[model samples]
Target: MEETGYTVGRMRPEWGKGGAQSLTFVVTEDCNLRCKYCYVTHKSKGKVLNLETAKKFIDYLLTSPDIHQSDSAVLDFIGGEPLLEAKLIEDICDYFKIRAYEEGSRWYWKYRINISTNGVNYDSDEVQHLIQKNSGKISIGITIDGTKEKHDLQRVFPDGSGSYDTIHKNLKLWMSQFDASTKVTFASEDLKYLKESILHLWDEGIYNVSANVVYENVWREGDDKIFEEQLKELADYIVEHDLYNKEYCTLFLDHIGAPYEKEDFNNTSCGAGKMLAISPDGNIYPCMRYYDYSLNHQPGYIIGNLEDGIDFDKARVFLLAMYKYQCDDECLSCPIAKGCEFCQGFSYDESDSGTNFQKAKYICKMHKARVRANNYYFAKLYHKTGIKRQNFHWKKELLFVLDDQYASFCSYHNEKISDQRMDIELVKEGLKFAEENFMKPVFLHSEQIADEYLTDYEEVEVLHRIPIQAYREDLPFYDYQIIVDDTSIDLLDKIPFQSNIIFNLSYENISKLSDMMEVVWRKTDRINLNLSNLSKTSDLSEYQRQLEKCAYKINEIEKHTGMLKELNVLTDIMFIKEHEGCPAGEDSVTLASDGHFYVCPAFYSNHLPSIGDLKTGIKIPNEELYRKDHMPLCEKCTSYQCENCKFINKRCTNEVNVSPAFQCKKAQIEEKTAMKLQKLLEGRYEFTNIISAKEFEDPIDMVLDGKMMRGYF
Candidate 1:
């Protein structure tokens, strides 16, 4: 006998990693019993996936290029009770394995036959034989809700007799043969059994229990409080028994309860679009949930058929367009929306309109209650273990433009009219000023300076060297950053440091940025993308498109390579929750070659009036105007990741605080694009905050329309 590869004590399913392709077979719609909370509205012996239908679907699935793209496959079997068709399932599994080997498919060895049964027929000798035959390649979960009382409440027969006695008899045998796990579902009627049922499952040696409250709109007014209290009770029981690490329950995860970065929250909860399901009639859906048997009002959404293959348009609706329908502005912008769950199929079925996009939020209150309980569990666990969460600190830095040659298109500087170089003495004086003002000093230079000269100003914390080709091994600076322009985009390979490279692209080269976005993530993490010259000719729509492409590129790299690199323009907006825009005069000031201090290097390069010279302490005539509070439109805005450059503000709006329509539109583009990116990367990373989708496009328009109050005039 082989070991069966089953862990005796613990079994946890991998969530959201996205490698395997799931193909579900509705083995038969017939069952021995009808559970009250079952999603399948119609069940009959006539609707069975016959041998011919199963073989045809399996052959098509194994031979299809789109289906074979996954490294592995999961052949999921489900029905009113899949075990009723145990022989058909066995034959299907055998054909799938043999066909996969015949075609030399990767799934020949990397496939799982997963059957979810209602446990009445689980003890059948035929089902037992099938399990033994494919012991190594199969996983069969027997759905037992927990304590006999709880299980009997909903899982009853046609005669209204409880089937718990029959299921309990096989638990010992089931646990002995497999790493047992069960699916526990709770509806409003069974709320009180939630805590004891979980503990009962654990006591019965079923350590891993995947559980959830129903997602339908059946939740009562005060059911959330009961759900929360039950979970807290379960938490106390697990903690008291020292079973936090040993037992598994989906409701009490450390990652839930808290708000995540907006981008990190999942767009859709279930694997609807990705997972394929075949009905007995040879029709295919994105998942079993989309089948007519599972839905309430709407007809089955068929994405493909055995003869015609997949309809990409229907599939795209599930994969790409479904998310837009599944959430509204309120749900998308919710602070604690990270772990909230929604079923796309259910949303489509329950939608008032015949649209597939509108999400049905019946589980919103339940999710909130779950989040609160999850928080309590973690707080208790951390208090017991004496662990603390880490906090983030934002530091300010001063930019010293070494010379005018390197000043073109610096993140702040729009243009360079002078080529005057800052002497070694002026550099040291600027560093001294930075040290006195409690700001980190950064040196920006166009040409490489002598090693001896770099050694002179050791106070320079970071040297942002322009043109990636300028780097050399003998350079004294070991931990400096690089800034790449359009001229140096191809020269990104010349960069020696992989960590701190910034690709500074201006608005004029937006198309070029899109062209090279595929290769940029391989070199740098941050992109200081901004509009150096926001002219009337600039099309806001085109910029939005390009910026969105860059955002998608970041998500693609993370999805394929599992390497998460940052792209500042879009990613920054996702992480920013408040208005923490550019800190020009407040925290950082620039020292020009002429020994004059300006708000930033852009003011110096463009020959704007200086705040003060190096001879006297820095002093701005009206410093309050540089702050966000003075700018009414900016103050009301939430695009905090935007730089909100004061130089551009003064150039376009003729005020330091007020932003022009161009600036506001660009910020809005980045902010909206960030929300899209967040949706793209939802399952890949766990974010703690959100880059919420704003209701308006441009904040300036909001002010003009009298929707928002005016700021400093």
Candidate 2:
């Protein structure tokens, strides 16, 4: 079960020093019925919490300095049926009410007391009084399995009679008395029952419903198909009823267009570290699920008892274990890793006597299927509404620089012409296409240009590359971009202060460019560094060193001149928020000098096949090859900040969709470095709160064990 290359460990959650603000009390273990899927093994034990024990727990919480600093607190009561001990709950509420009035107005104004009930005793006078007393401060969540027929089949009375009638009556009364929270918790292999149950609840005006599949039960053939069909129907029903517009329709649909960040991808879901649950006997556990299992006395399970207070050392150990828990390799690489609901409780329940990883495989199929269902559900809604996915369009602010014949030749391939000059006719056609597409085109030329060629396109900006030996008098139009290399570093002072300039740095001359940072900074604020000659074998350390040097120099200049000199690599990550990657043929298609259309300038430079000719228009042969979705590894990746350059992918792996190890590593390092630099300049600069960075391990290597090299077919 060990994923090769990945070091299996738990991930700790970021929580406040005081620990969990919410506390659950397993008020009683006594039960009035026998449910088929009950997790509590000792429901008939009849153990219950008295007023004295409940008071002790509350006093401990309020006395703790770290825990008491918050203006709010949640006191949750869970049991075989918490309503069975209605007097205890009433007394607890009274105590809190008196405390608030005695202490101050805000003392208990924000405090909430909630209970999860089976709704069997909700019609009782005592329970009704409790609800009326704490109108807004107290909330109750009643669990209904749906229609009477389906609910009675699984949940029944002690004598085996149906309890649905009693529960249903109580639910309606509770709903009318107070605007309480309600949900239908159902689990069954029968598709008809499951479907009918949901529809029944919705028909009864129970829109805030939730359901779960029985993880312990094995799903047979056709089960998945049934679930998927039901999901589709549910989605349609939601749309038809306009439930999506309602704030209380608890089924979350907001993740539809939300892009996941790095923290979202690589994190655990367990609340063990932050939450504490106390049993009826006053022993403390991580959560209600862990407490209900009756394993509080077991080593690593219990934190401490009410008499001793919380064992901070044991709690820390438990939290650490949960934080370090990693799932199987498949789960690690899953596209919906951020949305996974697997927790340490499920792991503990499913683990075998001797192993820790076996349980993950059992639930893998269900988890993946559910993720797909959610994706499909959202996709269908967006399609029906004509809403597009985020970041699907090419960046509007980016300028596409189309290089001509002289600049198209690759330095490495001196004998071969990687690109040729576009004929004047083809250039005119391309310009027409660009204008029609609303693209900002910047024609890049190394040789001299004629006035007639420039007269036709006065609106378009022309970037002229000047050789080191060229005199400043020979420079082209004043407002155009000036392209220079290491050889032209000294001549930067002569360039117009308002003119945009790009300093191209190759591997051979990066050191030279690094030496002229002071001069480059003093010359102008509008300068971009274009790092070229990157390959699989490129020196990452050297590149990193140069970037660090540039960052240091920029900081120095900002300090002296009181003006920030932006380092493209460091500053770009802060603003280019979402993963825009390389937009090859999507927004700005390149028309090569040879009268053919390629995905971009990189395609022509790499000698890849042209997508189409100017006469035929742009028809991508295999459009998915250049799409982010088509890149299996990249789509699942949390490195959403990566450049995702298609040219780099193809050059290193000989495939447009497949990313090289070096490229992924480099992008991650750059993102991490940018985050570090961001912290340093936080208050100094008003950077837009766009990009967020987190420590990321390469999932492909960690999970696939290098098997991804065989291609994600």
Q: Kindly list the per-residue Cα lDDT of model 1 for residues 1-713, writing each as its tens digit.
A: 11222111123556224568898999888888888888888888789898899899988887877663578888899887889889999999999988989999888988888888878877789999999999888888889999889999999998999999999898888888888989999999999999999988988998889898888778888999999899878766665665766777777654453344435434566788788899899998988988998888998889999999998877887655434446787776554565677777888899898566787888888887876566555444433433221221113466777777663444454455555778888877776666444355667767555343555242223445555666765665454666666667777776653765566666677777666655766666555554565664678787788878777777777887887668676776666566767788876688877888889877877778888877787898799887666778877788877777787778777888887776777778888888888888887767655767677877866666663546653
For all candidates in order, the CA lDDT equals 0.74, 0.59
Q: Listing every candidate in turn, what is its Cα RMSD in Å to the true structure after a full C-alpha superposition?
A: 16.9, 14.6
The numbered model that scores best in lDDT is: 1
- Across residues 112-231, which tens digit of lDDT does each residue of candidate 2 receive? 788878888888888888888888777787877878887888778889998889888776777775554455543544554765677677677665565666555456666666765666
Off by over 4 Å in 1: 1-17, 65-68, 260-266, 322-325, 388-713
Q: Please give the TM-score that candidate 1 achieves against the real structure.
A: 0.58
User: Model 2, which residues run further than 4 Å from truth?
Assistant: 1-20, 64-69, 99-107, 247-252, 256-261, 265-267, 292-300, 318-324, 352-361, 387-571, 575-685, 688-713
Cα lDDT of candidate 2 equals: 0.59
